[model samples]
Target chain A: MSPRQKRQLSLEVNGEPYELLVEPHWLLVDVLRDQLHLTGTKIGCGIGVCGACTVLVDGQAVSSCLALAVDAHGKAVTTIEGLAREGRLHPIQQAFIACGGFQCGFCTPGMIMGAKELLDRNPAPTEEEIRAGLSGNLCRCTGYVKIIESVQVAVRLLQEEMAGEAGAPVSPGPGRHAAVGSGQGGAR
Target chain B: MALWPFDYLEPTSPEECFALMAEHGSEAKLLAGGTALMQFLKQGLARPRALINLKRLPGLGGIEVGPEGALRLGALATHRRIEDAPLVRERWPMLAEMLQLVASPRIRNMATIGGNLCHGDANEDPPPLLLALDASVRVISRVGERLLPVDGLFTDFYETALKPGELLAEVRVPPLPPRSGAVYLKFAPKSRQDFATVGAAAFVRLADAGRCVELRLGLAGVAPTPVRARKVEAALQGQLLSEPLVREAAALVEDEIDPVGDIRGSAGYKREMAKLFLRRAVAEALRRAGAAGPGPT
Candidate 1:
């Protein structure tokens, strides 16, 4: 039996569907970390200012701490844990490690998620654009130099991955690598 | 950091939402994009009994231009959506550019422009710009709908002119004035996402050999509500514009604002910044207006 004032939440997280009976006030971060055991999403500052609890809801990066569990209903949610597929790390995650994006690692997940959103929209973002895209997420360590570098590395990695795969829908079209970090890619 | 338990209700239609608003009265909070409200809830600042989610309602998420060329932003349209709308970029490029810097990309992806105005913070960027643009919000209730000018929307700190049951349904921005140039200046000493230490927006329309046909100014971070810098505007209107002339008029901005000392800056510093920024905003606006020499009809 559902507890009093608890609502059932149905959402897809990390390619897995979850049906949760959550208190109406329960935040999406709490549910993902507690009930669903997806603790990769961290909570740095409880307020929305910190992107520590960032998650992609419907492919848009949003603060999970600020989102009600019920708001995730019928939406596809992606957390930090979702970046790896079939034991292969996503390009962003790989770039973060390769470039030393984080020292404490608390902000890495949110940073990667924010970068994912940025690269998805604009595969090759300028340094300024990359900074603007992930401005919402903050890192108290390393002064953001390596963090920015990580995103740039991710951009090159993603371009190489897409270029290697032919017939992939939405590949940044021909001569995309020429533009590099200065302009738009091929498709989307 | 726990939020108070509440009923989360999604109404499929405006009528149902209105009824829920009426039934719950003060206890029901409308959720558009809950960027600010969620902050309030998690902080124990708000304890509403129910949250009426407005996402299911149709026609409230579109950004369209009417035959008159006015831009209509649906209440549920997120800031990111409005910023990305090709029509907004084509018509109101300055506004599109401004939206790119509101909070951050993630926050913009979730915060509705309607909700941003409704949150009624005096230090926000959009209010001053909206005031300069002569925007109006359409408030809908079960009884009827009415348009309220942006100037008259914010009544007090952390408050708006909206009544308990009235929902702000849309923001209507008139087409950019003919041959007009606009600029929004913000003084955020801290991060780019922080509230403006002081901000100003101006619109200048040049007519007949660079004489100022019309000039308007709006300011924030210096008052309980976004202000129309009338004294400054009055000083410059119909005058042949010059740097000294603009500077002299902008000095009157000190009288237009009542800034409170906060983390942003002291009241005295804000007043001086207000004058400085107002002068810069007007000058930049004039430069832009002059560049559009032939003037668009």
Candidate 2:
């Protein structure tokens, strides 16, 4: 074992910038928990296998435990705590709560972050796509029934909000445009 | 709970990283995405005195097509980038699909292509696909640079041809000919957080006359390393992609692989699954080829 070395790093979390002295040995998950005191991101495997430590790095879900705090310099990160804005939960969080997407809640943060990416790129996704999107995350409590239902609920809520704002859109529903425009959509 | 202490050097230049590698030799390791390396460190499988972080190194992350139609996959290009790249999706959608099958969404966002290849896990889905695509891995050292075929890149399970002081630059996959289709299939138990029991990738080329002109079959997780099934290819060469021929080719994987029993599967079961995956992968590739504007005959 060797003494930990400190490094100067800057990171943006939940739309707020923080500059801190982090050890080279410090994992992003640890920094978020111990230093920043945002303990929403839980640690399960410590390795990348379990998605329990998932967080959004630049709007993409990543395992915080595998990420070095130094590697996150000059990047945008969002922990589970960042999802609620001004005491109002993000749509996904609300959907999770409404749909009962968690059981023991140990895997809820990672699952929410994973589904958040899917909804960001695709507000409406098929069950297969939803399964693929959340495949990395493992949940022993709910058997993924409520989790899938949670994403569906989020999609419906987002579509209803969009349709209400757009003032009655086409037959495909709001934000339901085919991925044919960008060719990013896969499967039905 | 956290990474062990080591001198971290985020070299802004590849030359600087390479020079540091040459100086530290085996005492150093390149940090791509840290998905695999970090796991290895936590498992006590790897520890080094220096980590040559490659993210800061210039020209290390990006995917582009070369003038010659080869797909240029940078070492630092994350799987998420590859999965989302329009170029990769347009030309080689199978690669994108393979990327999607690797780990979970969180892992894909941070796992680099170089890190996946260098991780040297026989169960990884990318190597078999890269091997089927006839991809080449570019390795850079302070001494010089060299490119090796994907099949030749792996020396053993958790071992690669990468020298101690060398860094993988990129994975270059040659363009497939027209009227070609490739598919990678893995038999991971539940399709979530499971290592592949048997993974097979098939790249098939149909002739203008409607016969099988060329075939490249690659398999992973059943052996010490991912292997190209030249035996199966030889059996199918010039043969009509008849159901009979495909069955014969599928049976050949059982003969060629030297599988090891593991928790995921017994050696016998892996051989069985390899045969199964080979058949499905070939049929899927052929079906895709046929669907691509009625290939040949």
Query: DockQ for the candidate 2 complex?
Result: 0.64
Model 1 chain B poorest ten-residue lDDT run? B288-297
Best by DockQ: 1
Query: How far is each candidate from the true structure, as Cα RMSD in Å?
Result: 5.0, 5.7
The residue ranges of model 1 lying beyond 4 angstroms of the native Cα positions read A1-4, A167-188, B291-297
- Reference contact recovery of candidate 1: 0.76
Q: Please give the CA lDDT of all the candidate structures.
A: 0.85, 0.84
Model 1 over residues A2-40: C-alpha lDDT tens digits? 444777788999898888888877888999999989899
lDDT of 2 at B58: 82
Candidate 2 colliding pairs: A136-B104
lDDT of 2 by residue, A30-143 (tens): 999999999889999888777899999888889998999998999999988998767867767867776678989999999999888889988889999999898888899999
B2, model 2: CA deviation in Å? Answer: 2.6
Per-candidate iRMS values, in order, are 1.1, 1.3
True contacts kept of each: 0.76, 0.93
